[model samples]
Target: MMREILYRLKDRYHFGTPTFQRDDLCFVTVKRDELRAILTELRDVEGFTHLTLLTAVDWLEERLFQLTYLINNREANLTLGLRVMLEREDEPGATTGDTIHDLWPTAATYQRELNEMFGINFPGSPRVDEEFILEGWTDLPPYRRDFDSLAYSQQTYNDLPGRKTHDPRDHMKKALYPTYLKEAE
Candidate 1:
């Protein structure tokens, strides 16, 4: 069934080869320009009505960001993941994606979070420029591979009073097998 749908749409849209991960799940890379139209057709014609998720993956090495839109057909128990690749830009707000909030209202929330976390802007998305999770965050987006989390933590936070750190292995050995080390020695 999935193959038939792909075959029908292959001529109309320029998409990459379909990769079937499972019997009910498939993934395909779709061009950025055709994403909105393809999504509309899938929802209206292919029965992929539910937008399960909209997420982004930062591929820093490749200098690209992969945006995946997973849609589901509840009646057919089929899931199709459409992936769109966007060039990763160093400057915040440079890398942008088309807004699909009109197709699925829930997409606005995901786009907002992506903009805040991954620095992938979705122009015209509702409140996308506003903070979603991070408040007053002027530093690099936390989810980006280039973001230095350790440096940020060290600079932003101070050690708590009387805070003691322990090695997990040693602590576990002492707690669970106190005599095992002595016997081995």
Candidate 2:
């Protein structure tokens, strides 16, 4: 069953590689532009009706963000992973492909999360550009690979009162030295 879908995708689209991870799971890497058409075909024709998950991966070294759409064909008990890559910088750019919100309204939430967390835009998704989890966030997207979380936290949050900045290992060794000496004596 998975092989049939693989062959169908190969015949119709320019997919990179079709990998069967298991008896019921397959993955295919595709270009960003072809994402919508492929997803539409998968949903409408391939019996993959459930958009189980949508997420992003930061390929910091390659300066690319890979968006993964996991869809499930409930009838076949099979899952297909569709992946597309885009430039990581979100500088008022367009969506890589058509938003799948029409097929799965739940996609809006995932798209919104990716928009806020990784700064990936989903052009046709309603409220995708709007804030999803964060409120009044003025810094870089927190989930981006290049984001400096420690610096952001230090600048945004106040330090706890009487909290000393010391290495725990060193502090522990110092505190145990006298006890060791007493034991030896």
Candidate 3:
């Protein structure tokens, strides 16, 4: 039953590609416009009513964000992974983002999280601007593949106020024996 829908997704949407990478999982890709329909059918028709998780992947050089929504229908013991991409263009951004809050109320939280973490706004998913996970962030979306976490850690986050830090590897001998100015093998 659900397999037909999966195939229709490929035939219906242009960018609705599927990654048959592994037998256990298949990700169905769809456009922003088609997301609502695809997700609705997956839930109402196929019984995939549970939204498992929502996350975004950053393809830095391509300047695209991949948003993934996982649905698990325990009754059928099946999972459907829906993915969509948002590209940053040179022109002005549109406020109409694909939202599934109408179909799955729980989707609101995921949408909100994506808005804050990836800077991918959900146009009309009530309280879209609400923040939950990260607070006091004034920089680029940290979860995007482009946002270098290590660099941010080095720059924005400092370990201590002004501690003279030593390399743990170099201090290994000292760490091994507090007094063991002992033997070296």
Candidate 4:
């Protein structure tokens, strides 16, 4: 019965049904626009009251990121994945995110983090322009694979100002410390 309701949105929405599940509650994937509708149905009709988690995965090599919403059916107390596959674009201006904050109040913070860390824009989400992580970042997002965390560290950070870049292992060598050669002695 619930599946039939969601099937109606098939043509109107773009989402993927996860192949794996362990319960009676069907896991149907729905688009961001349809997500509002589907989540409304779950809360008002099917009784999915808990939002377990919101997460994003970087597919930098593939030029995309996978966003996942873990929803639990309160009536049946079953968990299912609502996944959205977003293709990353070279043009940051073209990369826009969806807002699901209305469905879950807690989602606002998660959306903000995603925005700052990934440089994706979530339309209609409040305070997304505010920074929660990566203070004062001026370049491309640091989380993306192409961003180069090591290079950013080199450019933005200095190794204790003047401390020699010595390998700790060198200190343990017999030539450097006779006490370190106790085993060989």
Q: Give candidate 1's TM-score.
A: 0.89
lDDT of 4 at 37: 71
Ranking by TM-score: 1, 2, 3, 4
User: How would you encode candidate 2's per-residue C-alpha lDDT over 73-182 as one tens digit per residue?
Assistant: 99999999988888766453333535889889999999889888877787879987676699888777788888899999898899999988999887787687968856
How many clashing residue pairs appear in each of the predictions shown?
0, 0, 1, 0
Give the TM-score of each candidate: 0.89, 0.83, 0.72, 0.70
Model 3, 1-185: lDDT tens per residue?
35665765556555555665454456777777777777777788777888888877767688677888888878866677888778853222232257788887888988888787777777888888866787777766776666678888899776888889888876986887756565543
lDDT against the true structure, per candidate, is: 0.95, 0.83, 0.72, 0.72
TM-score, cand. 4: 0.70
> 1-185 in candidate 4: lDDT tens per residue?
44554466566567576444554445555566666776776667666677877777778788887777787776665666777768788755356767888888888888888888777778888898887887876888776667887787898887796777756686657467786588677
The numbered model that scores best in TM-score is 1
- Local distance difference test, candidate 3: 0.72
Give the range of the ten consecutive residues with the poorest summed lDDT in model 3: 88-97
Model 1 residue 181 CA deviation in Å: 7.0
lDDT of 3 at 111: 85
Error of 3 at 171 (Å): 11
